[model samples]
Target: MRLFLPLVITFICGIVMILHFFIPHRPISTIGDGLTDWYMIVASAAIFLGAANLVQVHVHRINTKARNWKYSPVVLIGFIAMMATGLLWGVEETLPFDYMFQTMIVPMGATMFSLLAFFVASAAFRAFRASNWRATLLLASAFIVMLGRVPIGGMIWKQIPIISEWMMQVPNMAGQRAVMIGAALGVVATSLRMIFGIERSYLGGAD
Candidate 1:
């Protein structure tokens, strides 16, 4: 019942959400917005689950005397500090959060985002060789995009903008639609598996 109910709800919600985009009718639009607002509230409530899991994992590691367990201390302290700063000092002060946010969290988040650049470059280098016709085309497309985006490339080659525009309009649109179709199929398959009780990884494993 637990599994069946959520799956049915997800399928119905997905249909409503998709239709809401095209229909533009009052009732369907209202239902879609309500579903979205409900999601936000539920998501806020569910964050406690993530916070609880983090504490549990870190505490266990510390208790077991794991190597470099000191990071857990930093995590715990930071979590508590942020919580207290928000709950205690609050919006009136605004100093603590702004200080920590601007100096610590923002930089850390930006650095984490920056790390993706290196990973993407590595992936591109490995996967984007011209060993075949398809690979060669993909590599050519990516090269045009890279050159079009950068100032020096634009300076050196004035035609980059025109090529980039066509690439975005034609190839990108085709790729996007293909990706969306594949993704939709995957979603339907997973939802079906959940509905049929075939996928219970979320309920935690085989007993």
Candidate 2:
């Protein structure tokens, strides 16, 4: 009964959404809009559930004194502090919430990204090694693109920038479009499977 009901609901909602895109009739459109409103309410409730789950997990870890449990308090403290500030002072500009976000959160985010740059450089170095013809071509393309972005590459060879631009506009764009098309097809397939009750994995057991 549990799985059957959800599958029925999924089929109905999926058909309504598909019709909403194609038909645009008054009755279908009204039902689609109502479904969308219900989706928003469910999503809002899920956010609260997720927050509660996070707090519960961290509190359990702190209470059990699990490995690296000391860090859990930091997560809890940050979550509580942000919530308190936003609820008490509001998130408007020049308020405590905004001040903390700009001064503390933004800098921390920047620092994390700065640290990630080194990891990316390390990965790029490994990936750019000319172990094969394909790797050699990749290394060369990367070298040209990197150099083209700098002043020295133009000073050394004016054509470097032009080649880099062509590579990005031609091959890179083609690859991106291919990926997007594949992803769109995959989404369509998955949605159809779910609508027809063939994708039973969502019910908890194997499909």
Candidate 3:
């Protein structure tokens, strides 16, 4: 009964959503909007549950003196501090919440991304090994793109920028469109499977 009820509900909801796109009658559109509201409420509750679960696990780890448990307190403290700041001071520009976000979080995120750039460069070096024809092509393309973006490229050869722009506009766009079409097809297949009850994996155990 438990599994059957959810599957039926999911199938009905999926069918309704699919029909809602094609049928724009006032009542049907209102119902679709209501369903979206319900979805948002459920999503918010799920997020709250996840946050609670995170806190519970971290607290348990700290209590049990698990490996690397010293970091758990920091996590708890940061979470609590953020929540308190938002709730008490509000998120106004002059408030502590905004100050903390702007000063600490923003700078930390920037630092993290700056560090990741070096890691990306290292990975790129490893990936750009010209062992085969395809790899050589990829390496050459990457070199051109990088050089094309710089002032030195124009100094060396004015045509580099034009070549880079053409490569990006033509090949890159074609690749992106192919990926989008493939993803759309995959989504359609998965949705049809769920709507027809052929996919019951979401009901917990395999069907």
Candidate 4:
């Protein structure tokens, strides 16, 4: 009965959304809008639940003295501080929330990304090794693309930028469109499967 009810709701909502896109009639549109509002409410509730779950897990870690448990307190403190400041003063400009976000969060995010650049470079170096013809081609293309973005490429050869632009606009765009089309087709197939109740994995157990 639990699974049946969820499947029924999924089918109804899926059908309604599909109809909403095609029909665009007044009643269907109204129902679709209401469903969207309900979805937002549910999403907000899910986020709250997720935050609670995070706190629970971290508290358990701290209590158990698990590996790296010392970081758990930092996580909890940051979460509580952010929540308190936002709830108390609101997140407007010049407020405590905004001040902390800009001063602390932004710099932390930038530092994380800066560290990621080294990882990316390491991965690229490994992947771009000219082991074969295909690898050589990939390495060459990546090199041209990277060099084209910098001033040194133009200084070395004026045509580098032009070739890079063509590679991006032509081959790269084609690949992107192919991937997008494939993804859209996959989404449609999955949605149809869910609508037909053929996909029951979302209900928790195996389909």
Whichever of 2 and 3 has more TM-score, that candidate is 3
Across residues 106-160, which tens digit of lDDT does each residue of candidate 4 receive? 9999999899989998999899999999999999999999899899999999999
Q: Count the backbone clashes (under 3 Å) in each candidate.
A: 0, 0, 0, 0
Q: Which ten residues in a row have the lowest lDDT in candidate 2?
A: 198-207
Per-residue lDDT of candidate 1, residues 144-187 (tens digit): 98888888767988899778878998989999999999999999
Q: Rate the local accuracy (lDDT) of all candidates.
A: 0.84, 0.94, 0.91, 0.96
Q: Write the per-residue lDDT of candidate 2 for residues 75-123, one digit (tens) a residue.
A: 9999999999999989999999999999999999999989998999999
Candidate 3 — which pairs collide? Answer: none
Clashing pairs in 4: none
Q: Candidate 3, which ten residues in sequence have the lowest lDDT sum?
A: 198-207
lDDT, candidate 3, equals: 0.91
Ranking by TM-score: 3, 2, 4, 1
Off by over 4 Å in 3: none
- For candidate 1, give the lDDT of residue 42: 97
Model 2 segments more than 4 A misplaced: none
Write the number of the candidate with greater lDDT, choosing between 3 and 4. Answer: 4
